[model samples]
Target chain A: SQTIHQWPATLVQPVGSPLSLECTVEGTSNPNLYWYRQAAGRGLQLLFYSVGIGQISSEVPQNLSASRPQDRQFILSSKKLLLSDSGFYLCAWSVSSGLYNEQFFGPGTRLTVL
Target chain B: SQQGEEDPQALSIQEGENATMNCSYKTSINNLQWYRQNSGRGLVHLILIRSNEREKHSGRLRVTLDTSKKSSSLLITASRAADTASYFCATDESGGSYIPTFGRGTSLIVHP
Candidate 1:
């Protein structure tokens, strides 16, 4: 039983506008996708990660960008938006290469770059 | 410049008392996770100690690891109030490069 979904839980862009956040994983099937960010007090900021479909692995480097295309879909992009980019946006999942690789999160997305 | 470092950034227990948090990291690790956030939501995988293993629990949470002095500690028993939140300590790096390196958390405030 695996389930991780994220959407526009809350967002308010402006700085330069243009950002899209979306993550999906139901019942798991080649999971292993992540993209964390929580700056306000700092901590938890691993940008992007994926282990399949197109494969992406960026740790940190500004504006933000990530994509996984299929295999459970995972995306988090941005073309502008910067006010430090805002924060609190997670979306994780594990169990793709197996072996006790704990990591399951979702239900987050609170951007506010104005 | 953070491979993990959480030590008394904030804490104010009271619900049932018993909340300890401490973490220190620098290099050489194979595992050391513990997360739980509930202020902005997300993050909730609390317990993963394996640097050759030192301690690990779940139900009431109890983790301890000290690969020499890399440090790690998280003990929250009897505490409630939804367990307040904010507690992180990650560091998985033993060459395999599994990706995990977070710190700067420890804001538990369970005062009911």
Candidate 2:
């Protein structure tokens, strides 16, 4: 079975601080990875997605960026955090290639920028 | 703007009562997916219904899709307190893009 993992389950950082969150998937290769942020009691906003290693796609212009260093390893980073960046950060993977498929998500990280 | 919108932003019902949630989308889609999220947790994929298919069943869950209406509904039978969470509907475009757009979600609360 495939499993997705995320680190720093919870984080509290001061404003303007750098941010780095990691996501790794075991038992799957060349999977589509995505980064999403959800505000309190709201829907997900697609931040980034990657089709393969070294390839990243940004859905909305924001303070965050994503990178896929390895086939199953994806990282979401920011040079400086903003108050608006506080939200539930999620990582998901899907077996899709321009085809509709179900996505599997990780436990997620709760980031609070104070 | 959100591509999908869920009806009855929030719902409360007693255990054993059936809970139904509806979703309306704005454009053509290849498939519609349902996901469940416990409080402060990541979402769990529940079911997916292709545009070509009208209905699908998974254990205690039933999903219905109407391409003409550009809408879908999820039915949870004999709901339990554990079902107290948010349900989100996601739709993928029929075009060449594969990214799925999600709605705000319907918060369901099932009293034990």
Compare the candidates by lDDT and give the number of the best one. Answer: 2
**lDDT, residue A76, candidate 1:** 94
lDDT of 1 by residue, A1-114 (tens): 888999989999899989999999999688889888888888887888888988998877777898898999899999988898898898988887644567888988999998
Question: Every model's DockQ, to 2 decimals?
Answer: 0.28, 0.80
Query: How far in Å is the alpha carbon of B21 misplaced in model 1?
Result: 13
Candidate 2 pairs with clashing backbones: none
Which 10-residue window of candidate 2 chain B scores lowest in summed lDDT?
A: B92-101
TM-score of 2: 0.98
Quote the B-chain TM-score, candidate 1: 0.34
lDDT of 2 by residue, B1-112 (tens): 5888998799999999999999999899998999999998999999989999999999999999999999999999999998999999999888836688899999999999
Model 2 collision count: 0
lDDT of 1 by residue, B1-112 (tens): 5799999899997999899999999888888888888887888887887889899888998998989998989999999999998999888777855677789899989989
